[model samples]
Target: MRRSELVLLASFTLGLLTTRDAFAWCRTTTTQGFVPTSEKPCDDTGIPLYWSTRCVGFSVQRDASRWIDLATTRSVAQKSFDAWKNSSCPADPVSCTGSFDQGHPSIEVKDLGPVSCDCVEYNGKVGNANTIVFRDLAWTECDGTPKSDADTTLALTTVTFNTETGEIYDADMEVNTANNPITTDDPPGRVLYDFQSILTHEAGHFLGLAHTNLPQPTDKTKTPTMYARYEQREVYMRDLSNDDVCAICAAYPPNRSAPCDTTPRRGLALECGGGDPETTTKSGCGCMVLGQKPSGLDAVIVGATCLLGLGVVARRRRR
Candidate 1:
């Protein structure tokens, strides 16, 4: 198949976006309700485009040790941190580096004495420096700072890119169930939120992905990596879809496109509109469309026909 054709077929198999609403969230774990109807791009100034080069890291700290076990909480945070590193670091090691790895540009988790601030603040330290500190404030004890609606839940707040300081700060808090478990849309009941799931989403923000507005009219409906919702049963805080990987790759295509054989492989079935390949047209060629298995014979037939057409063209040219 032609390169473009191969890409399209791959996209169809992987299920590319068809409509804007496809990216919208049905619900959010935060009290802010669903993400606001805003058309903000992931990074207005384009800093995220180079974020991978800057080195992504985090520090988990606790203000007080009351609500949950510090060891358990740190373990959970580490799990989430590792998830981000594995998926995002393959392309840019500097930006996706974590404390576990022996790197300078990394995230650090520190214990601050108590759960004073809203869950934690990932503010860009040293004037936009890429750093995140996870502060677990045992409960509703504000760190002398007044709590606003924005700070109520363990929400990711303030993604600032400072050109002067060359730093980026992103912060958020962890929900403390010491007093009463917060109610959320997730299945756990009582403790409405899932720590890992919420952190995974926030980490995406830290990586510079914006909230997906309802996809454009021509896009498909699928769960996006940046979707503004939390899955109840999800435990790993770091999980990314092909689209997410594609976005990061596009932002930082290696100095040169890696040879096709060198490209990392993925294992998953690529479905388009819940239909077989015969009914779908290939979209684009990139890492986003690789390794998607077709679900039916129709898809195989479509692929075969395309390959045959290419063969015919090659023969005619040879003659």
Candidate 2:
């Protein structure tokens, strides 16, 4: 019926610490979760929130951007996924200088081909995979971005999950081609939003990674990809920072194992076909009815009759 709130406010609201200093990465919390535990620890505060499975699925919209061809778009998307997939600890803390030689494995990010529509859905009658879509026009889908009514968001990642088990079912990304000039190649003097940079950032959210509130030191070149905001042509966002890799590895480890179906939310037919896929999963593993978009995943209150908990972390919030 409605979409859930994925905007994270903590990243901006809190004053950031230096990279040498340890800080917290914001996670989505539901009424049932966000509790306290050493294993599934919250921040200094107690809140248990993390993706319980690996092998997340995502799809790209068929209508390619005018600035880039369909093949180029998909290629860039795959490269973004690989950036995180290849991330490890040494890159962090300056090549794991402060940490040991423990290695983190990569999570599987499946690429399901083109589709007709680029809107978010949450009805049980149909099923869809996590999606990456391009909006060449104004963003009108979910009443605009989480921060305001105006269209200022460059891109977003909306994740749906089961509050009861902290299991994510669907995660989708939408890039704002209407507001920002997105491009694959760099032009002299003209600043353009790099597709790979933003895709890597959004993919972190899709894989259950959260934004870290830590600020980059004056001499630093790049912070975490999960940092709340990024500057145009900031290719540093294309890769995982130490914090980005650390939080992700902690949440969904490389060697971590689970029962996951990496299959696209829609089958191959929907991938090659030029239309939206079926919305319902007979086994009900894809999505369920939420009725309305949630306000904030971390602050959601679970009522007596509330359905299973689903966590969402939107990438557009300034805070």
Give the winner by lDDT: 2
Runs with alpha carbons beyond 4 Å of true place in candidate 2: 1-21, 31-52, 89-101, 142-151, 186-191, 264-319
Q: Which ten residues in a row have the lowest lDDT in candidate 1?
A: 304-313
Least accurate 10 contiguous residues by lDDT in model 2? 302-311
Instruction: Report lDDT per candidate.
Output: 0.34, 0.55
Can you write out model 2's per-residue Cα lDDT over 133-247, one digit (the tens) per residue?
7767565453354322224467766666544545565666777777677777754544467777778888777776555656554644557777667665556777676677666
Cα RMSD of all models vs. native, in order, equals 22.1, 12.5
